[model samples]
Target: MDTAAYALLVFGALAGGFVSGLAGFGTALMALGIWLYVLPPSLAVPLVLICSVVAQTATLPSMWRSFDFTLIWPFIVGGLAGVPVGTLLIAHADPQIFKLGVGLFLLVFPTVLFFNRTPMAFRFGGKVADAGVGFAGGVLGSLAGLSGPLPILWASLRGWGKDERRGIFQIFNWTVLLAALCYQAATGLIELKVIWLALIAFPGTIIGASLGTRLYHALSDRNFGDVVLGLLFLSGVGLVWSTLGLR
Candidate 1:
């Protein structure tokens, strides 16, 4: 790669790492959008997965004390099942259409949350419901490298505290992205170029994640939720733009 491409890759990694560190998700949403400017989807997606896992793992030690297996296990099981299905669809499905649909949902869902201030008061079913959301997350993870939005939105609706939400986001993202990375490696979707880019990007990931985790610790639960919602909205806009060939 040229210096310009390398620079862009590093910058994208830093930005995406910071976002993931703060919000406990959104590494792909932030990095893939920027990386796609310099690399194709085939290359960019795997790089995003590598950086995401790195960022999430970096923050895990801080969140381990608050981890809730009961809430996260069902989602993991459901998401694991959905990933292969999504991977299969990638070869057969029109990705632009899928992106458009998901973008619309992301846009509308946040608006609903913004208007409905008492979102948590409305119970959104039980563990079965959580698993269903996780399945959707897995499908999106495999299809778009964007599995966090659905679960992030669900955590908001369920009225989890910042730590609780972070626990879910950190563990869930790590699990799904790690699995996706392994799948990509096994299928030979991950190339040597992607590995080189990951190496170039690692330092930025560490720096940004360190800064972002500090910021995350400082924010109130309400403020953190608002920030997450805002990022989701922006990610939706990015998806819509890409699907329309505007980016």
Candidate 2:
């Protein structure tokens, strides 16, 4: 990659990583902008895995105490089961449709909680729900390198506030991202240039995720939810545009 592209990735790494740490799921949106600037979407998804995984690892220890392994593990299993399916669909399907679908889905994801009369009782969202969310995460993740919103929404609906919610997101993001990364690597989609960019971006993500863990107290629960929703909306629009080949 050229200096200009590398530079953009560097800036994206620091900014996105910090946001993810603070907000819980902005890294994908942040990196999407820079990745689009430097490469095609197809190439960007695999590259993002490299950076996302590092950020997740960095933030893991801080959030470990807050983790609900029972909740997370089911999703991980489902995500693993779904990644290949998502990858296969992505490999041959039309990109524009994926964008529109994801955009629409994201736009709706955060709103469901606002209007729903009955919330999901604990028992209602059990192993099946976790697996369902995980499968969705893997599918979207493989398609757009974005899959954080679903899990975030699930947590939000459960009355999980800012800090813990972000922690869950960090862990979940890494799970799906690392899984996808492994798939991409096995399939030879990850190029040398992608690895080069990853090397430069990883440290930035690590630092930012660390800082986010420290600054988790700064944001209010309402604000955290709002920001996450807004970012998802904006990122959704961006993804739709990308689907249309506009970005």
The candidate maximizing lDDT is: 1
Question: Taking the tens digit of each residue's C-alpha lDDT, what string does model 1 give over 69-149?
Answer: 888887888788788877777678786797788888888898788777774833666888888988889888877688899
lDDT of 2 by residue, 1-247 (tens): 7888778888888877877777766777778766777787766777677777777777777667766676677777877787887777776877667667877777777666555545344455677886788788878776667768777777766665566566667766777888888887898777877776677888888888778756765667776667777777777777777666774
- Give each model a TM-score: 0.95, 0.86
Collision pairs in model 1: none
Q: So what's the TM-score on candidate 2? A: 0.86
Please estimate how well model 1 matches the true structure, expressed as its whole-model Cα lDDT: 0.85
lDDT per model, in order?
A: 0.85, 0.74
lDDT of 1 at 73: 88
CA lDDT, candidate 2, residue 50: 73
Model 1 misplaced regions, further than 4 Å: none
